[model samples]
Target: MDYNLMREFADSWGLLAMALFFVGCVAFALRPGGRRQADEAARIPLKDD
Candidate 1:
């Protein structure tokens, strides 16, 4: 296995940004407000085609 490359990849800013984004998404999904908003949006009908 390429330990050096893997280490570099994991340590890069892009990976950190993605990880933070993933965590934020998970947190948002688990929030009551988020769930409620999603549910309400799903039930809403579009006014126009």
Candidate 2:
């Protein structure tokens, strides 16, 4: 395995992929109806199993 080549690829493509994934997650979290889902999840720990 070539460490320098891998580092270059990660510095380019890996960073782009991470940025896209982060944006997608933020968009999903902010979408309509997300608050309702999040509220429901917030109650799970207090609910009877």
Candidate 3:
């Protein structure tokens, strides 16, 4: 495999993929019911069985 070809692919497509992934993660975190899930998770460590 040629280094230059791989570098070009990463510079273009890899960057786009990472950007899309970041946006997806942000959207998921902000989706409906996310706050409730986050609140429940926050109490886990303090809860006693």
Candidate 4:
């Protein structure tokens, strides 16, 4: 509950958690077969209902 403890947790675990999340997102975006889904999503706004 103290500032020092919170700061240390943020500097260590928080950084690790954020890094892992970013890497997971990058992996998902770059994975095989994702291009087709991405292209479809990109054209959603231009599609008529």
What's the CA RMSD for each of the models? 4.9, 1.2, 0.6, 0.5
Residue pairs clashing in model 3 are none
lDDT of 4 at 28: 100
TM-score of each: 0.57, 0.88, 0.94, 0.96
The candidate maximizing lDDT is: 4
Q: Provide the overall lDDT of each model, using Cα atoms, as 2-decimal numbers.
A: 0.84, 0.99, 0.99, 1.00
Model 3: per-residue lDDT, tens digit, 1-49?
9999999999999999999999999999999999999999999999999
lDDT of 1 by residue, 1-49 (tens): 6998878877897688899999999998998788789977887795354
In candidate 2, stretches whose alpha carbon ends up further than 4 angstroms from where it belongs are: none
Error of 2 at 26 (Å): 0.4
lDDT of 4: 1.00
Candidate 2: Cα lDDT at 20:
100
Scored by lDDT, model 3 comes in at 0.99
The most accurate candidate by TM-score is 4
| Tens-digit per-residue lDDT, 1-49, candidate 2 | 7999999999999999999999999999999999999999999999997
Instruction: For candidate 3, give the lDDT of residue 2.
Output: 100
Compared to the true structure, candidate 1 yields what TM-score? Answer: 0.57
Pairs of residues at least 3 apart in sequence or in different chains that clash in candidate 4: none
Model 4 ranges with Cα > 4 A deviation: none
Residue pairs of candidate 2 with colliding backbone atoms: none
